[model samples]
Target: MVTLTSSTAAQRPDFAAIANWIKPNSKILDLGCGDGALLKYLQQKHRIFGFGVEIDDANVLGCLRNGINVIQSDLESGLSGFADNSFDYVILSQTLQAMKHTERIIREMLRVGREGIVSFPNFGHWKNRLQVIQGHMPVSDALPYHWYDTPNIHLCTLGDFENLCKQCDAKILERRVMKQDRPIRFLPNLRGKLAFYRFERQNKSPKSTQD
Candidate 1:
């Protein structure tokens, strides 16, 4: 009998902010939904019907114990299981950078869900540039991995992500940049440590599907 809780103050900050964007009773699919914390919070707060897709076995168990709906699967293989527009929203929180097939997964996200929300650490921050100039990989609280051992394989900047979105014909509905959970408005690429975007496909059609 395992259960999860988020009573402490130092818990991750994106759950509440992301919850604000979701409408009540709207269906949601959360990719990489660790321990179902954010899904649980949304259920308790917004009463939205939600499901989680997690790869880790421990996290799958945690989701079950927490009474959250979850599926265990690797993200890089792609999301071909869901139907077109099966959900009102699909969320990818802090998992985009580590993915090898970012473009493919993103396209799948938009295909399976009407709108997709993604958050990732911004690699274009000024400090990262400074570290490169000084000949050392940047290691910050948001991106705490050495270049050689980092899980984030395809890290992208704000500009880089925007260009990818354009290539995918994704319409950006909302954008937020932050420094340690607080908002970052001025010189976001240089100052912001985290970035979030909510978007939808300009044209609605499904390409990849699974039996």
Candidate 2:
């Protein structure tokens, strides 16, 4: 059994809104898990058997101290070691923009889990749009990157992500947009700071599946 230190247990967010959507006692994989906060929260609150995959050494150690099980691996390499359908849900939160191969990573997430939850900063927020029109990079809470020094390999909008989901043959089960901690569903594309989506790969016909 894992044993998390008290100091490590105090940094998690109130993910109750998202946690409510997940099935209780489900096995979960959290990719790019920073500090393993979410994983610990899931374990304590939902009785989930959560696994965290993180690349940062400090964060990996922090997860261990927090009594969370974690695997240190680069997201760019893909989750090849895990068998298909190994988890009930695979989560990627706030790390999609940092990946160069977003589609491939998402595909692997779907293959390894029955369902996937993905959340990313929305580049189409009204403030971001306004900044673009004014010929400046947006510096908001969601996107704190400047044009010169930023880790984001790809910057995408809500519409862009939705189109990509359709093109990749993934079905969107749910979508939530948030500003700060409040839900903003009415005009998410224009107002939301973050966009969250729950998705599953569409079942293919036997012939297509074989191909």
TM-score of each: 0.92, 0.89
Poorly placed runs, candidate 1 (over 4 Å): 1-10, 209-211
Candidate topping TM-score: 1
Which 10-residue window of candidate 2 scores lowest in summed lDDT? 202-211
The residue pairs that clash in candidate 1, if any, are none
lDDT of 2 by residue, 66-177 (tens): 7888999998988887877889999998899999888888788778888888888899999999998999988887888787898987888889998988876788999988
lDDT of 1 by residue, 94-202 (tens): 9999888888888889889999999999999999989989999889888999988898888889999999999888999999988876889999999999999999998
lDDT per model vs. reference: 0.86, 0.82
What TM-score should be assigned to candidate 2? Answer: 0.89
In model 1, what lDDT does residue 28 have?
Answer: 94
